[model samples]
Structures are given as C-alpha cells and as structure tokens.
Target: MRIIIKGGIWKNTEDEILKAAVSKYGKNQWARISSLLVRKSPKQCKARWYEWLDPSIKKTEWSKEEDEKLLHLAKLMPTQWRTIAPIVGRTPSQCLERYQKLLDEAEAKEGADLDLTGPTGGDAGPSADDVRRLRPGEIDPDPETKPARPDPVDMDEDEKEMLSEARARLANTQGKKAKRKAREKQLEEARRLASLQKRRELKAAGIELKGKKKKKGMDYNADIPFEKKPALGFYDTTEEKNRQIEPGFTNVHLHKLEGKRRSEINEEKRKKKQKTDSEGGVGFVPARASQLNKLKQAEQISKRRKLLLPAPQVGENELEEIVKIGFAGENTKAVVGETDNVSSLSDYTPSSTGLPLRTPRLIGGSLQTPRTPLSVRSLRTPTTERARLNRRSQVVKRDLPRPVHVDELTIDDLTYEGSEIEKIIDLEMIKLLKHDAIVYPVHGSKLNSQNLESIESFEEFTDELMNQAREAINAEIKITANESDLPEDWPKFEDLTGIKQCQNQLEINRNLMIKDASRAAKLEKKLNITLGGYLVCYKVSRSSALVKKTLESFEEVEQAKIELDSFQSLNLSEKVAIPKRIETLQNEVDHLVRREHELQERYATLLNQKQEIQLRIEDLFAKTNGNA
Candidate 1:
C-alpha cells in the first residue's frame, strides 16, 4: 500500500495507499501533504501526525527575532512601505499597520523615544501652518501678496470730515422728535390760514355756514369727472374740468332739483311701458300653467287617502285603557281598544290595545303556545348524548401534560409539588419527561431502583415508539370528550436533526474518562475503574443531556455561592460606601444639569437685556441730537 504523493502510476490504490503512507511517514512531512488524494480519511490522522511533528503546535510560541525585524522595517520607512515589505513578505498596507503598532508600542514604553531617528523620517514630519492674516476690507487674500487697504481709523482728515457731515445730516433728517415737532407746526399754520380764508369767503358771499356745512380748502373742481352733463338730447362739446360741490344750501338745492327732474322722467317712462305691455298680450302665461298643474295633482292625491277618525273629547282619566295611537286629519284621534270592532282572518285578530302580539290571551276559551319547527327538535339527541358522555369521561380521566420528572411518579409516592425528592431531579429530567414518562411508579420508603433504571432506559429511546402511545391516548381522550383537537406543531427533540451533537459530546466525555482513568491507574497505583468515579462516569453515560445540564447547573450554583460568599465577606462600611458613592454621583449630576439650565437661561436673558439697553441708548442719542 505504499504510495508516493506526487507521481500517480507508481502509487498504490488511493485510500489504502494513503493510510499506509500516513502510517509510514514522519509527522512533519504528513502535515504539508495531507490535502492530496489519500487511501483513507486523512484529516484527523494527518492532523495528529502534524501535531506530533511540531510539539509547539499545542501552544504556538512567537519568535522574538521575527518580531523585531518586522518592527524595525515597519518604523524605518513607513511612507515608502513597499520597499521593505518584501523582506517580511507582507503588503505595503500590512507594513503600515505594523509600523503604527510599533509606534503605539514605542509610545507605551516608559523612556522610549517615539521620534524614529532613522535615515528616513515617516509621513508625520512637520506640519505647515494653515492660518493667514486678513487685510482691512479684504477677504480671501492671495498668499503671495500683501494686503492693499489701510484701516478705517487711519483715514485722512478729509474723509473723516465727510463722515462726520454724513452722520450729522442723517441724524437731523431721521430724528423722530424733530420731525414730529416740524410737522405739528406746519399743520397748525395751515389750519389757521384755512379758517381765516373760509371766514373771508363766507362774508363776501353773504352766506352763513353751519358746522356740517363748513368748507374744505379751495381745491374746487378736484373731484368731478372731465365731462359736462348733457342738455336737451345733445352731448356737451366743451372739455369741462371736474368740480367739487360746496357743503351748503346752494348744493342741497341743486341736488333736489336734479332728483325731481329724474323722478318726472321715470314716471313718464313707466306710463309708456304699461301701454306697450297691454298691446303685446304675452305675459305670465308660462308661470300660471305650472301653478295650475301642481294644484290639480294635490287635489287628486287628497281625495284617494282615507280620513282618520277624530278622538273623543274626554278627560285623561276616562281614556286610560283606550290608547290613542295617532291623530287623523288635523285634530282627530285614532284609538285602539280590546273590545273594539276590527277585521279578523282566523278568529284571532291583533289587539288594538297596544299590548305585545306574542302575549297569550283567554280568547274563545282555548290556550296555545307558539309552534316550533320539527327540524330544530330532531337535531338535539346526538349532540346532547355526546356532551353528557364527554362530561362523564372528563370526570373519570383528568390529567394534564406535566414535566417528565414530576409526571413519572404519582403524587402519593413522589410528591406532586416541589417536595424534597422533586428538587433532586435534574432539569433535563424535566425536559425528558415533557416528551414521555421517565420512571415507573414506585411505593414505600425503600425505593425500587431496578424498575426506575428500566424506565430511565425507556425514556432515552427514540421518540417514534413513545409518540405513538401518546397519540393513541390523545385520540382516545378526544373521542371521549367528543371535541375536535389541536395538532402538535413543534418538532420532537429526539426526531430533530442535531442529535449528532449529543453523540459528539458523549464521545468527548468517554475520551476524557479514558484519559483520566489511565492517568489515575499510572500515577497512584489505582485501578482505572473505581466505584465512585465509575458511578459518576456511568451517570454521564446514562444521560449526556442531563450530565451537561447538571454541569452547567453546578457551575451556576458555584458562581452564586461565590457571589454570596463575597457578599458575606464584605465589611460593614464597605457595603454602605457603594450607596453613598452612588448618591453623591447622582447629586453631582443633578447639580450640573441645573447649573447648565441656569447658565442657558442667564445667557438668553443677558442677550435680551443687551438688545433692550442698546435700543434705549439709541433712542437717548436720537433725542439728544434732536434737541441740539
């Protein structure tokens, strides 16, 4: 079965040849060539041989020489990285990363100089200053040139004089107090002159003006249109200017004359219109025809409807039983009474007394209940029998799906609720019991271990058999209950694809046991199979799921115990110190947040105050200038 790895024809059969070759080969040679086609599955064997070849494979040791070389080359020429990367067989980026790491290490060293004083410095050498000074009124100045403007304060005397004049002119023209005073004086003078002129004009015209007839200023013809009124069927030829009417008796007399003339003209036009309409003979015919048709239809509908009878004029107490259901016509009452005459089809007429239709009455000496259909009565027998049987079965058989550990033994024997014995059972036992029973029933204080062991074995079998029994029992129970049942949707754990996980775990546990056994037998002159260790090993073998769970539980218990011990081990002051520290931190944070809010509020208030003060100062300056 010998085979050389490279040349094909000279080798033995592929799998057999590989197995033989691996057996003969040295460990170092096997590691490098394991990927080649082999006689048998070579991964594990090849790995084992490779591990044998290099004892350091168990714990790989880093070489100081290689580490130093990488570090030196990395730091020497970091920017020109590709030049030195080939020495270490890495890319430029990798070299750069290594250089950064070396830089970090150099920084961490107590007295090491980070300034890599090498033949070539790296990219982080000297930085150019990125700031520039601005000239007056100049933005984005050229880096190579000097700025071109002098500062405003350095202006010549002429410019300063011009600026002062501009400011003075602006102050005089825009000042509010000066402008208001000037406007008030102008208005007073204009009003006095206007009143005097009006008095002079009224005296010259020999007319007395009342308060409502006082004249406005002499802008006469300011509101009239630029056209003269027509006179006697002829338009005026002259381009007349607009004229304003004076508020006096003269204007009132003129308006009254115009109104009287217009009224006379309208009366004459109306007389002509009435004469023409009488001759035309085509008015109101369309409107009257529609009105007559609507009246006729209303008359026909009224005649077809029956009139309701009027109610008897009686007091409220006299008409107690005779209910007035509705009024007929405008004021008539329609009443219904038990003895009132009404049409009846089958010797039983609906009562007019407003009682319920279904209420039985002693009519013609006969009593009858409302008839029910036959179909409804016939459908009840099977349903009621089924319900009664279900209730009886439920009374006889009442069991809930419980956890395997708790369910395996009955309440009288094992304690249904969490008693002492129930606590001892593992959680995995609970999970298993959820699938099916884990133990047979037992009695007495002396527990029967044999049957319990058998039942445990039965619990661990593939779920196909146990599920069948469960399905049958469920079907039977559903039948007894006469109710449709829900189907199980979750996968059975034993039916799941990952059971290989449990097998792998078991294999690892067996290997560990074998190794420990061998070590004990060799070291202490003790046999590999002791009763105590063997029992523990047997427990592991019996339920790998449970053993794994138990180990995790023990770890958690140990952690909890450690935490409890640490709590118990605390000194009195130390325990109290934590809460005090926390309180101090919370108070500090609260104070800081309050201070931050206060500062923000103060900043806002100060900004508003500053603006208000600026406005007030501006107003004061304005008033001072106006006075000056």
Candidate 2:
C-alpha cells in the first residue's frame, strides 16, 4: 500500500526516519527509502533530505574567496552550476543564486563608477588588482607608472622560461641597435655634407635664404621717420599722387569720342587705299570679293548663252485660243497682232490702272453659258461626296444563316408507337406508381382540419403540459437554492482576508489529519484493533478537501502576487512619490542655503561695524580719561 504523505510539515521524527532510511538504503535508492518510510514517496523523500534534512548542505553566508571561485568557475563554465557547485562546496542552486547576486553587485558597482557627467567627468580607470594582473608585454601608457617585471627568485618555472627568452631577445636587440646607431651616424654625416654643398651653391648664385627678416624697431610704421612723416589721417592721399594725369581725358563728351573714333577709322582706310594704289593695285584683295566678281562674270555669260538658245516650238492647237460669244452667232475667227504672229497672254499688256482688257471671241455656231454660283450649304457638306462614293463602292451584305447548335438533332422527326413508348417507361416512374398504393395521408392533415373543438382541446392539453413543466422547474430551483445556501459553519470567500483565513483553516485540517493518523498508527501498534485502516481513506478525503480549498485560495494569492510583482516592477516615480517631491525639497534646501549665506555675510559686516564702533568708544574713553 502506498502511503501518501499529504500536506504536513516535516517533524523531527519524520526527519530522523528519512535520515535513517537514506543511510541504510543509500541516497539514490529513494524508492526503497520511501517504502521503508511508509509516509513519503521517492520525490517527497528526496526533496525533504536535500532541501531541509541534508547536513552537508551549507545555508551560511558565502565567503569572499568562495564567491570569487564561484564567479571564476561560472565564467569558465556558464550555466553549469552543478559542475561548479562541488568546487565551491555548495548546492548547485545556492551556487547559482550566489553567482547571480555577485553579478548584480558587480554591475551596480560598474554603473556607479562609470558616470560620464558626474563630478569626475571621467572613469577612475581599472582597479589595482586588474592592473597587477596585466602581462609583462602590456604596459600602462602613463609616464609615471612602469611595467612590472617578474623577479627571477620569485618567478615560477613558466615565468623563468619567459624571462630567459626575453633576455635572449634583449641581447639580439642590443646588437641590432648598435648596428642601427652606426648606420644612423653615417646617414647624419651624409645629410650634413649634402646640406653644406647646397648652401655653398645657393651663396654662389647670390640667392638669399627665405626666413623672417627682423624689423629695425617694433613699431609698425618705423620705416617712416618722425620728422618727414605726413600727418596722420583716415584716408591716404598717396594713391591719388600715384595715379597718372592724362590731358583732356576726363570731361570728354560721349558724342565727341564717337566722332573722333569715326574720323580715325576713315583716315586708316584712306591710308590703306594709298598704300594699295602705290603697290599698283596688285596687292591682296579679300578672297570673297574676288569670288563675287567671278560670279558676276559667270552670270552674264549664262545670260548670253540663254539668249542665244532657240525658243521651243508650239503646236497649232496649243497656240490657237478658243473663245465663246454670248449673243453673237458663232463664227470662229483668229485675231493676230500686226507686230507678232502669235499673240500670247504674256505679250498682252495691261492698262496703267492694272486692269486687263476683256475681248470677246466667236466659237463654231454656239453660245457660251454662264457659270452658276456655288451654294454655301454645298460647301459645308465636305464628306457628302466621299460618303456617297464609299457607299457606291461598298459590297452588298447578305444574311447568312448561323451554324446550328450541336445538341439540336438533324434527324427526321417521327411519331413513336404506343407499344414502343410503353416498353421505354422509366424505372423511377414505375417505382413511384408502385409506391402510390401504400402511401399514407399527407403530413399534419388532421391538424389542418377546421374542427374548432378538437383544436381548442389540443391547445388546452399543451397549456396543461407547460404549466406542469414550469411547476416542476420551480420546485427544482427552490431545492437547488436551498442546497446551494452556505452553512453557518462554512468559511466566507468575500475578500482576500476571508480567503486567506479559509486557507489557514484548511492547513489546520491537514495538520490535524496528519496528527490523527500518527495517533491511530500508534494505537494500531498498541492494540490489534486496526484503527489506522480507515485513516488512509480519511486522510485522502481530507487531502482532497485541503487541495480544493488551496486551489480556491490560489486565485487570491495569484492576484496578490501579481500586484506585488507590479509594485516591484514600477519605475522610480510610480513606486514612490519621493523623486518628484524631492525636487521641491531640493529647491527649498537651495533657498535656505542661499539665505544662510546671506545672513553669514550680513553678520560679518555687522561684526566689522561693531569692531569699528568699539575702537571709537575705546579711543573716546582714553581721551576722556586723559582730560580728567
């Protein structure tokens, strides 16, 4: 039989029993221990021993060395607390907790130390311990501080080996340094000699070296002698004296300047013409002028050539003019000019008013008809001729039958015989005909009938049934209300306080069950009455009640927990009103401080005045004593 150790705090007897069982059965054999103990399971027994009963587990404050070791181990193996726990002589959970605490402290310290805008305005630098841990090759850049070298006597084996290697390196570097010094000396001598040669060359060439020339005196205008210097004035007249004076240059009119420039240009052209005439006109003329003269000669030659060419011959029909007479009877006649045989239109001359002379001609026995005037509407219909022409040229459109649908049958229509139709009857139709014989009346046929008495009787029956159901439901509701009513003995759940009180009562009941079971076990041992036989069942029921009460109270506890978490997580101002109020208090403090300082100064002044008065009074007393 499994003995469930329900909701009871561990007692000394239980602890002793667990310890003995653990000792006898070993730590890992929790199932055997649980069986031996009879009141705890493997999980419960293990938790009891490790959490509270274990003597090896330390619950004391962690030492500095232990903390350092834990931190180092944590850095070496992060999150593996079980590995570090043994080395630190603590449980894994304790080690993890201590490490977290240390880390938080270090972070806070770092934050406080690293204030960029604080009084120091800079970091205080690393700690002395960190500096001491620096390697030999790494040196602080501060001039006052020197890199630490390990003493041979104090050095470990590794350090000694490093020192020997460093000494060898130093020796090699010294040799290289001496060679480098010799090379540098040679280079310096070469540079000195070259610079001397360069200076000699410059001096031979009479070139002065560029550098700052020293002034005779510190005064800015020391070059000007005191006696010969002009009077000090804001504007200098030296620039005016330096300007050139041209005769009749300033006040010349713009028109006169333009006329003078034109005359000068004419004189230049006349001189050029004289020079050309003196040279017998064989001097260069512009290529464009020569080309123009040649073009004119070529044009005159082309005109002579065109005049020498014969005129084209005209046909008789083309030369003959056809003229129609309006009232004269038609008699064709050809009129020829006396000077020219063919009187062309080009040869005809118009009068001075630019009007042409109209002459009538007779045609072959017919009268000419006058042209009719065009209508405005005919001019507006621009597309009429085009549309008519298009319509005349268009092909005629004939109606073509559309293709018939594929489902439409092309076979000839024929009437079917009755015998053939009968042979082709549908299965569904036959089934329906067979079903018609056994078919019952339509649904609700009786209800649809106009029998008022029967309808009233049915409604009365439904009303009676509804009333009976309502009464039954009302009785059931009353019974349930009575059953659900809280007894006077039952605990209240109105508030967190009442719920907490109920939780406490449930805990007490659990404790009582544990006590009673223990007592019953003792009684069973003393007598053979089997008193503890029912205790298990009783304990189970009590545990269930306790669990139910705990679960019920859990909601309140959870709410409180959430509130606590929210309170803890609140920022500085929400958590407390101090920060905002502190500003006002700080202002008051500053005001008080300023007032105190002013009062101090005033008191000092008053003290000085009192001293002066006291001295006067002493002097007066002395004089009065002297007179007396």
Candidate 3:
C-alpha cells in the first residue's frame, strides 16, 4: 500500500500503509515504519500509531482499579508516560491522557472538598451509599421486562395524576443530580488549571517544590546536664538555711537585759530611786537665811529709790521777775555768770563771812549735809529760780510786733431804720426757705380736679387744707406789695397764689410719698432677711440630706464589698468548674465556626453553579446563532 501527504490530506490507503508499517516495525521503530510507508514522515507515522493504530489506547471509561494503578505509576514517575505505559498496560499517550484525566478529576474533587470545608457551607452532602439508599424503588416489578405500550382505553384519573407526579419528581431529582455532577466536574477543571498555573509560576521563579517535613517528638532529657543533677538539692538546702536564721533577730536586742539579769537591773533602778528620794528627789536646793535677807533688803532699796523727791522751793514772784527780765541784754551777762558759779560749786557751806552755803546734790537725790542758814541773796531767789533765769537767757530773742490801726477795718458797719426794718419783715427768711425746700411747684392750680382726685387718703386732705392756707398768705403778701417795689422775677398775686398752692400740694404729696416709700423699703428689707434665713435653712437641710445619702451609699458600698468577699470565698471545685464551662463553650463556638464554614462553601458552590449555568446558556445561544 502507498500513502500521499500534501496539504494535510489523508486517504484510506494512508491508514492501511501506516498500520502495515507499524505491524512490520513495531510501535517504537517509527523511522523504520516510516521508510516502509511511502510519502509519510516518521513523526507522522508515530503520531498515527499512538493516536489511532495502537490497540492499547483506552477509548472506554477508566475503571477504578486502572485509575489507581495509573495514579500509582504517575506518582512514582511523574510525566514519564513511556516508562509507566507498560506497567499500566496502555500506550504512553494513553497513559498520559488517563493520568491527566485522573489529575483533572482529583483537582476537581479537591476543589469541591475545599469548598465544602469553607467557613459558611451547609452540612455535608449525601455520600454514595446514602444516595443509593435514598434512591426510589423501580417502577417495574420484572427485572428484564420493559413497560408495555399504553392501551387505547382511557386511564383512571387518580392513576394518571399519580403517574404524572411521580414522573415530575423523578425528573426533578435526576436534573438536580446531573447539575451537581456537571458543577463538580467544572470546579475540578477550574482548580486543576489554577493549580497548574501556580506550579508553572513557581517553576518560573526558580522555587523548588517540596513537601512539608514532619516534626520530630520532643526529647525531654536533651537539656538536662548529668553534672548538674544536684542543683535542685541546692534550692532545698537554701530554704533550710534561710529558716535557720532567727526570724526574731529584729527584736532580739530591744531590751538591755533579760531573765535573772533583768531582775538585777530592776533592783539597781530601785536603789537609784531610793537614793534620789533621800536626796530631796533630785530637784530640791536649799538657800541660806542670810542670802534671803540680803535679797529682801535689795528689793526694798530698789522700791525706795523710785519714790518722788521734793522739788526745790522758789517764790512765784521771783520766778516771774526772772522770766520778765530773762530776754533783757543787761540781765544776760548776770544770768551767764550765775550759771558758771552754779556749775563750779559742788556743795553749800557757810562762808568765813557768815554767809549761808547753797547745798549741791545730784538732781535725783536730796542733800545729805546739815542745814545751813540761807544767804540774803539765796533767800530772795531760790536755786530753781536762778536755773530758770539762766535757761531763759539761752533762748533766741523775738522781733518787735507791727503796729495795729483801728481805722483800717476791711468790713463796713450797717445802720438800720425802723421803716426799712418794717419793710424787710421776713422776706429774706422766706426766700431762704424757698431755696432750701425739697419740692417745687409746677405751673398749675392745686385746687384743680386732678389734684382733688389724686388725694387718696386723710393725710392728703389735711395737706390740701394747709396748701390753701399757705396760698392765701402768699396771695395777701403779693397783693400788698407795690408793682414798682416787687422784684422783676416775682409773679402776680393770682399766679403766686397758684404757685404757692402747687408747691404746698407737691410738698404734702412728697412727704406722703416718702412715708410710703420708707414703709415699702422696710418691708423689702424684712422680706430679704426672711429669704436669707430660708436660704440658710434650705442649705443646711440640703447638706444634711446629702450627708445622710452619702453615708447610706457608703453603707451600701460596704455591704456590697462584704458580699463580694463572701462570693470570692467559693470552693475550689466551683472555680475549677468555671474554666470547664468556658472550655465547653469554646468547643461549641468551634463547632459553630465549622458549621458556618460549611454554609459559606455551599453558598459559593451555588454561586459558581449559577455562573456556570449562565455561561452554558450563553454558549448554547452562541451555538444556535452559529447553526443558524
């Protein structure tokens, strides 16, 4: 047989030629086989043998046992299909294809398992056994019998309805199962492709693929040193050594003596006390009688020293005469000479000529010498008078006074006539009184209706009568005054009467108003005092209430503290049980977390299935359009 290859065309003769060549040369000798087949390349011959001519190629579904064997060989020799082919009883290409299918299925199953173990998936799906158990019974009783064709007769309505329902339910369950399988297959393919891409990326980055190594168990004896076996004994001895030291060392030397020595010390202290008592209790010291008498005499002398001494006698007339002539120039020399004589003389003595001596003593004491008769000059002017005259002589002199003139008065004297006195009357007094008055009149009559109506009390009525009297007096005075004699600013009789009445009314009103104001002010002050007392009382009450409330709150707090203490004094079992409860709750929380993970996975699967269905629908639409 002969074959031709031009523009990828193949004929029945080509297949025959390839088969015949393969049969003669075997599957491996692609070059020899190609030489026998004319117009065919060795590569082409090899591809044809593996793809079509080889009887070992698995066109049927791979069984479980075959799949397991393939997986085992693939794991032992990854990507080495030629080496694994004979062991699996398949061609290299067939082995490779089966291994790849197994890998895709494994990846899909892993992806589905991963989705099932997620944070929010529902409970696990039914297993194969559960699915089988849940499968409905067969409708037909006979194993080999098919349902016969429906008779031409009409069926019972109930039977028809039941059949239809059964069909619908069966259809629904089958559709759901098919959809689940399709979704699982799609997920497997997607995860497989993703895993492949990840491996490719890792390979490109020069990272070596390796499995996680298992950790070895801990060796407890590794860290212990044989030489240090007695180190733990050191801690035990340390505690004993610490205990041997006296705990009462701090108070051991507090007392100076102890036991029999303490009694001896007490006896010595008693002896000391007895000796002190025998010696006047340690603080008594007796003074001599003579020393006491001397101290008394010294106190008496000091008291006598403070008594007033009699002043020297001098005649008032003599002292006055000295003061009068003290400032005279002629007496100045005499006064100075006397002062010198007084400074030089130490004591008064009788002179040889029978003159009395002036006694000299300290200014603070009396003279101790016997009395001598006074000299004529000394009797006339005493020592005090002489001293006064001398002191006056040392004073500075005053200038002469200026002369006074009686005719040079600055104020003028007044002369009064009987007629002028009569005219003056009380006009000045009235004007002064008017100026000092607190109330002034408005330009209106006091007898007006408004004024009358404004009088609200008896006081106001009396005020009106007084105003009328004052107005009459003012009108009489104005009427008696001549126009030429009247002041320029003075009003006429009628106007003056009206003004006086208004002033009187205003004054009365002012006094009445002032009395009311004073009363109101007194009332306001009383009210303020009452309010202040009330505020003080309120503050005191509030403070007391606050103190009471605070104490009550404190009591409550103390009670709560006591309760807390009682609660804290619980049994060891109860305390231990609390942690157990916590652990159980933690376990429950872990279980809930797993449940939530399952729910999330189920939701994700549903979402993925929805998306796949949408994609399939889109593909179907595309295919329909393409067919059209």
lDDT of 1 by residue, 1-628 (tens): 7553332121222323334444444444554334443321345435333322223332222245556877777567656766875676544445554566555556546334654543434654432121223446765322111112333436556445644553443343335676789899999999989998998899899987665655665545665545586567866655454555555656356657566676888998999998876566458756666777889989999887797989869978756534532222112312432333322111222446874667475677665665557432323356556754453212133554332224344333421357565665544354344323322222222334443654454334334655687799899987786333323423444345346455645876899899999987687654444455886778668798787899999999999999988878686668879999999999999998899789779989998999999999999989998999
Please give the lDDT score for candidate 1: 0.53
A best-first ranking of the candidates according to their lDDT comes to 3, 2, 1
Q: How does model 2 fare in lDDT?
A: 0.59
Which scores better on TM-score, 1 or 3?
A: 3
Backbone clashes in model 1:
10
- The TM-score obtained by model 2 is 0.17
Across residues 329-444, which tens digit of lDDT does each residue of candidate 2 receive? Answer: 12211333343533221222224685335433348645444335642123324454565343321121122321111122122211223454553444322322222212222332
Clashing pairs in 1: 14-39, 15-39, 16-39, 221-243, 221-244, 310-332, 310-333, 311-333, 404-433, 404-434
> How displaced is residue 362 in candidate 3, in Å?
99
Cα-based lDDT at residue 558, candidate 1: 97
Q: Pick the winner on TM-score between candidates 1 and 2.
A: 2
lDDT of each: 0.53, 0.59, 0.59
The candidate 2 region of ten consecutive residues with least summed lDDT is 402-411
Model 1: ten consecutive residues of lowest lDDT: 141-150
